[model samples]
Target: MGRQSPFLLQIGVFILFFILQAATMRDRIIGGREAKPHSRPYMASIQFKGKNICGGALVNRIWVMSAAHCFDNLRPESMQVVLGAHSVTAQEPSQQNFTVQASISHPNYNMETLENDIHLLKLNKAALVNDFVRKISLPKQGEDVTPRRKCIIAGWGDTTDFETHPKALMETNTEVVSRASCNSSWTGSISQHMVCATSPDNVKRGFCSGDSGAPLVCMNRAVGVVSFSSFRCANPRFPDVYTRVSEFISWMEDVMRSF
Candidate 1:
C-alpha cells in the first residue's frame, strides 16, 4: 500500500515504544533507594511457603498488621512472618521468623473491592524486642494525615514490572494527597477508609506488587496500610492507596485484645 507512508510508520514506532516503556515501569519501585539496614525494625516480610509475598509491620509483641488481600485464598498456617530482616535472601542474625497463630481479617473486608483491606496476624509466640526487632506505634484513633504531609513506605517488591522482588528492602519519600484530590483522580473510587500518597513533584515513587500491607509511616506512626496502586506503580497520574489505619483503630485494638 504505497510502502505504508514512512512518516506514519515512524509515528507508529514511537507510539509502540512509549507503550512498552510504560508497561515496563508499571508495578515497580521506581525512584526509591535501598533502606538503611535494620532501620525499619518493625518491617515484616509476610511469606508464604518461605517466599516473601507481602510486607507487614509489627504492631505489638505478637501482632503483625498487613493487608487482608495478602491472605486471600491463603491459609494462616502456611504463612510465616519474618521480622528484623534487611534482605529477604540473607540469613541475617537479626531476623526472627514466626509461624502465624491466627490471621484476623476485618469482618467487613471485601475481597472483590478490597475494602477494609487491613489484617492482623497473631504469632505463635511473642517476638523478642531487641536492637534489631521492635514494634511500630499505630496512629491515634481518628487521627488523619493532612495533605502534603511527609511520609515513607518501604518494601521488598519489584523495582520494575518484569523484575524479581528486591533482596534488600527499599523505601522512598512520599507526601499525603488530599482525600478530595485523590478521590477525584480515581473517579471517586477512593473511599474514606483509604488514604492516598505520591511522590513530590510528580516523581515516580511508591509501593508496587508484593508491597501490599506495608505501613505508610507518618510522624513515626503507621497511619495507613498499603492496599493498592495504579497499574503503573510510579504513575504520576494516580497516587498509591492505603487502608487508612486510623479508620480501623477500634477494630484493630479489639482484635489484638481479644487474641
Candidate 2:
C-alpha cells in the first residue's frame, strides 16, 4: 500500500499539477547538512491529507513564502504551517503551529510561463519568536546574488524519487550558476527574475519536489525560493530554478504592510 491513500493521491496529483504547470519542477532531494534549528525558524511544512505537500518560509509575523502552484484549488483555511520545528514528526509541545488565514497568489502569476511563482500566506496569529523560531532577513533591494556564491537549500522533501517524504529537515550547500549557464541548461526558458543553483562537481545535491517555496538562503539573507527542477531530479545540466527574492522586494513589502 502507498503511504498516501487513493483520495489523498487524487488531491496530491491535483495540487502537484498546478505545481508542475506553474514551476515545471520535480520533487526535492534529502540527505545533506542538517539545518540549524534557529537559522530558519520561519521555515514551515505544509500538510494535506496526512502528507506533506510543500515547504515554505515565514516572511513576517503572518506571511510566508511559497510557490503559487502549491495553493492550486486549495483554500487558505485548509492549510496549516508547522513552524519552529526541527522535524515534522517532532511532538515537542513548544512547536508553534499556525492555521492559515489568507492566501494571496501573485497577480501576475502565469502557470504556463512559470512567471511570478511566488505566493504569500497570512497567519491567524503572530508566530512567537523563540530559539527555534526566528525570521530570516529578506535580501536588500537591488542586491545581486551571482553565480558561485554559496547558498543553502533546506526542506523535508524526499531523498530520492521512489522514496517517501523525509521525517526530518535536511539542508545542502550549493552555488549559484551564471545566467548564461542557467539559460543554456534550461534551454532559454530562464528569466531575469529567476535564478539557478547546482551542486558542486555536478553532484546530485539540489532541490527536488515537495521543496517548493523553501528558501535559497545565503549570508543570512533569503535570496530565492525553490520553484522548479527537471524531471530527472538534480541533473548537472538542469539547474534548479527559483524566484528571485531581491526582485520582488516591493511586492513583498507591500503585502506584508497590509497585514
Candidate 3:
C-alpha cells in the first residue's frame, strides 16, 4: 500500500500548491550557470499544462525517472515531457513533446520523509533517440556513490516562488555528502533509501522550488532523483536529499518489465 498524500507537503518554503501553479516554469538553477543545449541529453522537463513542474531523467525510450512527490494531485493527462529542451520558455526544433500515458509512484513511498520517493513515467510513445535527446544509463544494482563524488544537477524550477517566468536550463556541480554528515544536519530526517549532495565549500548551493524530481548524475550514470532540499533553498547547512537509484533498481526493472 502507498503512504498518505502529501499534496500539502511543505517544500522549499513554497506551499506545495504554489509550486504546482499553472502558467509556465522556467530554468531555476541557483548559484549555477546556464547549461549548453543538449549538454545533458538525458535531462527532461516534466511539464504540466505546458509549464515546467518537475525535473526528470530519460532512462529509456518510453520511461522517465522522477520523484514520486511530483505526482501529488497531478494527473497524467495534464502533464507532458519535454526532451532536448534548453530554454524552458522557448521551443526548439530539437525539442520533442510527449503526452504522459501513466505515472507510477512507488507503492511504499513515504510522504513524511519521502522514502522510496522515486517514480516512473510512461510516455504515450517512445521518445525519438537523437543527438540532443538520449537515455541516461542506470547504475548497476548494489552500485554506490562514493562520498564527495562529484555530480551534476539540472532543472527549470523556480529561481524563487515569485519568479514565474521561464529561463534557460541551469546546472551546477555538486558532490555527495557523507550520510553521517547529512544526517547530522537533519537529525533522523534521511533514510537508508536516500542519499544527500551538497555544493563544494562556501558555495552554499543545492536544489530549490520547482526542482523536484531532478536527476543527480554521477560517473555518467543516473544515481539519484532530486527529492527535497532546505525550505530556504541552497542553505549550505542542509544538503539536499535524493532517492537512491541503486536501492530501487529491482523495483524500477520490475515496473519496466510489467510494461
Give the winner by TM-score. 1
Q: Give candidates' CA RMSD values in order.
A: 4.0, 7.3, 7.9
- What's the TM-score of each model vs. the native? 0.89, 0.86, 0.87
Candidate 1 residue-wise lDDT, 1-259, digit = tens: 5579899999999999868765444224557899999999999998877777888999999999999988888898888899999999889899999999999999999987878999999999999999889999998888889999999989887876666567699999999999899988889888889999999888777776438889999999999998888766767788888999999999999998898
Error of 1 at 74 (Å): 0.6
Residue clash pairs of candidate 3: 26-166
Q: In angstroms, give how far residue 215 of model 1 lies from its true place.
A: 0.1
Clashing pairs in 2: 25-229, 26-209, 27-208, 27-209, 28-208, 28-209
Which regions in candidate 2 have their CA more than 4 angstroms from the true location? 1-27, 36-39
Ranking by lDDT: 1, 3, 2
RMSD of 1: 4.0
Is candidate 2 or 3 superior in TM-score? 3
**In each prediction, how many residue pairs overlap at the backbone (N, C-alpha, C within less than 3 A)?**
0, 6, 1
Better of 1 and 3 by lDDT: 1
Off by over 4 Å in 1: 1-28
Assess candidate 3 and give its lDDT.
0.83
Kindly list the per-residue Cα lDDT of model 2 for residues 1-259, writing each as its tens digit.
6477899889989988766654534446544766666456768887775456788888777788888878878887788888877778767665787888889888898877778888888888998877787778898866779789998888888766655556678888888999899998788988888888888777788877448888888888889888888776777788888888888889888887886
